[model samples]
Target: MSHAPDLGSSAAPGAGAGQREGLGELFSSVTEDLSTLVRQEIALAKAEATQSGKRAGKGAGLLAGAGVSGHFVLLFLSVAAWWGLGEVIGRGWSALVVAAVWAVVAAVLAVRGRSELRAVRGLPDTTSTLQKVPSALKGHEEENHR
Candidate 1:
């Protein structure tokens, strides 16, 4: 299943020091290139993971902002109601009563926001899955060789 080019047809060498080019030197150069490539790929992977984390963080922050804004809206509405309904309910007690109701509303919204945060935890797990794929493939290679 390897996609590597076959070395058989090429002018690539075997174990002869002066034979066109040393296989060890060729292998060393190839390994050096591979190492550089792997390092670059790792950097790219890290950047991708960091981006995903930022996106998830932004999403969670947005949800929290929504919950907070909802709470503020309800609280402000209750405050507005208190101003209007002060005559019907007792003047001093209406503000306290309205605030109590709005507090309950805020609590409910907070609970909902907490439930929504669970999905953000999956983001890092997604990146970890990607990181493990190479190791998993290497394990398969070992099994095949056995």
Candidate 2:
């Protein structure tokens, strides 16, 4: 059941002087418990969101870094190929082969990254909180073993 914050704090009960102190203590305890519960829920939300963000960030960083590094590698390879071709096959054929190879590399990385990206897309990463709950309760190290 959803907590009605106001209901728990106000409109409970208070009697005469003796009961007043007792009631105040009771209310204070309840309030503390409620506050702790709410804080825990909020912390869980933040932790889960952070985890989901890191997952995407890592994936994106890898994809972008690999994409750039792959392109650079291709550039160097093409230059080397062109230089070699110029010595043997001449400029025109070297340019054509380099362009063709570059196109092939681009298409391959696009296809691969697109496929990997699709896996992570549209996942309700927020609900990952549910999965994390058990682990979060168990402590971080214990969670990893599980």
Candidate 3:
């Protein structure tokens, strides 16, 4: 009579070798899954960064266009004012008056801009949160192990 190896029985030497092979397959599967997850996360981060950069670039371009348009408007208005003043006073005095008005406006803007820049501080809260990241990760790892 021939005997068949019982599937559930591990008493046979061949069964032990088969179990080791199964463990090796499980380990390889886990490694592959982990590698795939890391690659997907990196791709997501890169896509997000690229999208943000594009948005920032578009906004900057729009801002530059607005600034140029505003400059042209200001230039036309200044010339019109100078010509209108020239019709009443002499051309030389009208030019001097326009120059003085622009200088005063420039001074006021510079002062305001300086004060506003001084008010802006560094990102204290974000810096504090980033400093705690390592400890937070370590605690999370401990919780997961438990």
Q: Which candidate is the best by lDDT?
A: 2
Model 2: lowest-lDDT 10 consecutive positions: 121-130
On the 0 to 100 scale, the lDDT of residue 23 in model 1 is 64
Residue-level lDDT of model 3, residues 31-121, one tens digit each, is 7866775576566556666665565555555455545545655675677576767676566455556566655565555455455445444
Per-residue error for 30 in candidate 3, Å, reads 1.1
User: How well is each residue in 1-146 modelled by candidate 2, as lDDT tens digits?
Assistant: 87657764455543365588888998898678667756876776777667656656666765675577567667767776767766766764566576666666666665665556555543354454455655654456356334
The stretch of ten residues in a row with the least summed lDDT in candidate 1 is 137-146
lDDT, each prediction: 0.61, 0.62, 0.58
Clashes of each: 0, 0, 0
Q: RMSD in angstroms, candidate 3? A: 8.8
Please identify model 3 stretches exceeding 4 Å from their true place.
1-19, 88-146
Ranking by lDDT: 2, 1, 3
Give the alpha carbon lDDT tens digit for every residue of 23-123 in model 1: 67877876786677567667766766786676567657656766775676676666767675767656546666666666676666566555655444434
Name the runs in model 2 displaced over 4 angstroms: 1-15, 73-81, 84-146
- Give model 3's TM-score versus the native structure: 0.44
Write out the backbone clash pairs for model 2: none
